[model samples]
Target: MMISNTPPPPYYAVIFTSVRTNDNEGYAETDALMSELALQQDGFLGMEHASSEIGITISYWRDVESIKHWKDNLDHQKAQIKGQKTWYSQYKVRIAKVERDYDFLKK
Candidate 1:
């Protein structure tokens, strides 16, 4: 499948999808924190997103180890726990490695 501004070859993409709970407290704060930390991580590259209720954020990373580190990061882990308990009604994370990619932009 063709995606806009396809990620460069040989990168890891962490696809995050979430259904937010309307009454959850600290949702925006935690979400923002996660984004900030992700950008600062060792293997961080870049990200793109299309979000609403069921949102998707694909973050590019250097390798599996970096991705795994993010997965187990203390702050992010706390946020994940909070999300499961109070923020997200449901969520799923999928990681994929891109060996090749292509895109077409309007001229």
Candidate 2:
């Protein structure tokens, strides 16, 4: 389920930052499939970001296992390759735990 509210402390968040390559092949279709995969996963909290040539997306998970599962997923695996080969020139993935979080929202 989508939760706009803050997540509990001790959660895991994967920050995927990428710089896209000039060559884009089947990008739209693959991107859509990745979104679909995220929606189908139980641990997916939500993502917040802005994407273009450079992008950052933070995907929340229940634990490391969930994150690993997504990494090993066939479709995602393929997408990762496509990213390296075509979509992204370089990318960085960081997995971290939320020991503390602070946020202020305007309503």
lDDT of candidate 2 vs native? 0.80
lDDT of each: 0.83, 0.80
Q: Which stretches of candidate 1 lie over 4 Å from their true place?
A: 1-7
As a TM-score, model 1 comes out at 0.85
Q: Please write out the lDDT profile of model 2 over residues 31-105, one tens digit for every residue.
A: 878988986887776666668768888887878898888898898998888788888878999999978878775
TM-score for each predicted model, relative to the true structure:
0.85, 0.85
lDDT of 2 at 42: 70
Q: On residues 6-94, what C-alpha lDDT tens digit does candidate 1 reach at each position?
A: 34689888998988778757888987899899978998887777877687888889899999999899999998888888977888999
Residue pairs with backbone atoms closer than 3 Å in model 2 (clashes): none
Q: Worst 10-residue stretch by lDDT in candidate 1?
A: 1-10
